[model samples]
Target: MIGFIELIRASGFAADVRQVKLVRHKGDDLDMDQLRNEGWFETYQCFQSKPVFDGCTHIVSVIGEDATASRFVGIYEVQGSTTASPALLPEHCPYTQWGTESRVFYTLKKCPGFEDLEDRVVIDWGKGALAWHQWLTDRTIMEIRPRGRVLAPFRDFLRVHLSFEDLGNLATQPTAHKDWVAALSAVGGIYLIVDSMTGAQYVGSATGSGGIWQRWCDYAKTGHGGNLRLHELCREDIARARHFRFSILETFSRSLARDEAIRIESFFKQKLGTRVFGLNAN
Candidate 1:
């Protein structure tokens, strides 16, 4: 239960405590899924309908991911701000059109001395939605997960759901998500990979000694997992792999035979029409 300000000071942020504001940003008016999946959160936070940060010299930005927990984004030094206009929005702004004219567009630059702490720190934002912005001096640190937070804890096979980014993170930083990796490695299973961009799906199985964990790690590294269709899809454009979402279709006990796992995988491929209508070619 260390104080968040103490961590900031320890990290070499020499600014006065009074000049810092803790801002927990959530997307209520925007498409949060798209923001998270497509990287629109920063622009969304940069321009807000209200001047919430008017009096702050520096703001510690956090993205609200849970009911009272927020993941640290970064410390931003406020350069200046202006009344939002249609022309003020960047071309990549998620919205098709802007109808609100009362918004404020902030000009912020990433503050130095806090780069190592970004995305690795989480703080307990004291209960309540009304106080999204508060003086930094009033808050305390909650938990600092190494390599940042994983998608979620491993509850059961049915609860397994991961985006491409999540799989990559788990594959690269196994210790941070050891529970999930351990669970995945303990049993072979049938898994599903869907392309969110085209809604194309591929059903596959993992029957090797390393189980589903090893299979997914291959996908994370090569973006194909040695599948013919997946390799072709990624060969032309590797970035297309970012649109993939992974989930478990069925789990099999370690004693299950390799043919049995493949049989279950084939059933799902047929049920989902993945062979003729989706990404699966075999």
Candidate 2:
């Protein structure tokens, strides 16, 4: 991603100016209709350049281009504060002159007909030329180079072990899964309850009646558990930990919820080990 600052000069003292950034094509041979069809048409209009009598300043960011990504420009609006009434004196009413400074940035990507360039360039109106130049220079200095640890790449295909326990202390109901499901539904979504002290993790889903805390409490008392890998790991260390932190990483629509849950289980098994439960598919 790139960032830039822009300054615009507007007519009169109207603070309301629309900042439309656009890229102008250098070649006349290019077809405009084809470019428009690709959704690269200019979406904004530039303010009319006129004399200003009041002084006020506003800033904005703009991004757009033609068929070629290289032909893009970002814009900013700079407005001066002044009354449009003719009765005001130039000096006393204070006609303001507003000039804006804009900076632009770009990323690397394929362009069909153009030769690839090592660096993306920016063009802007000359006001704070030095400042804009410095901005670009600083960005170049801070560009990120990807490197370091590369994790096992095929984790998405793995199956995870998950475990569960009914902690309610009451007799296991005829609706074994449904009762706990009701309790968990109140909390909503999937959560990881981690016992930091024991390096243990618990992955579970809930809906409707019980919060995560209540579901865990039920698991603690009953010990009547499910045989998924994650649950067994947590159960092993249940005697050593008294506190755990619950983290909710994602929520899914009902249509995708089951698939998402399975995916989450696999992820934790590969990334977090045995503490997560409910992922066993085989």
Error at 69, model 2, angstroms: 52
Which one wins on TM-score? 1
Error of 1 at 110 (Å): 1.4
For model 2, residues 1-282, the per-residue Cα lDDT tens digits are 342222112112223332222223332543332223223322111212232211213232212122222222223333333322333213332122211212111211222221111112333322332221111211111211112111111111121111221122122332324433343344445556555345566556543334443545555553323535444554676543233333554444434455666676557655655433333323
Q: List TM-scores for all candidates, in order.
A: 0.82, 0.25
Worst 10 residues of 2 by lDDT: 148-157
Candidate 1, 1-282: lDDT as tens digits:
568878888888887768778887776765343466677665666677788878888888887765787877788888888887778767866473542577888888887877677767877888765688888765667777776455545678986768888888888788888888899999888899988778899998987788899889999998888999989999889898998889888888866888887788889999999999998888
- Those runs of model 2 whose alpha carbons end farther than 4 Å from true positions after fitting are 1-187, 207-217, 223-238, 241-243, 254-257, 273-282
Clashes of 2: 34
Candidate 2 achieves a global lDDT of 0.32
Give each prediction's root-mean-square deviation over alpha carbons. 3.2, 22.6
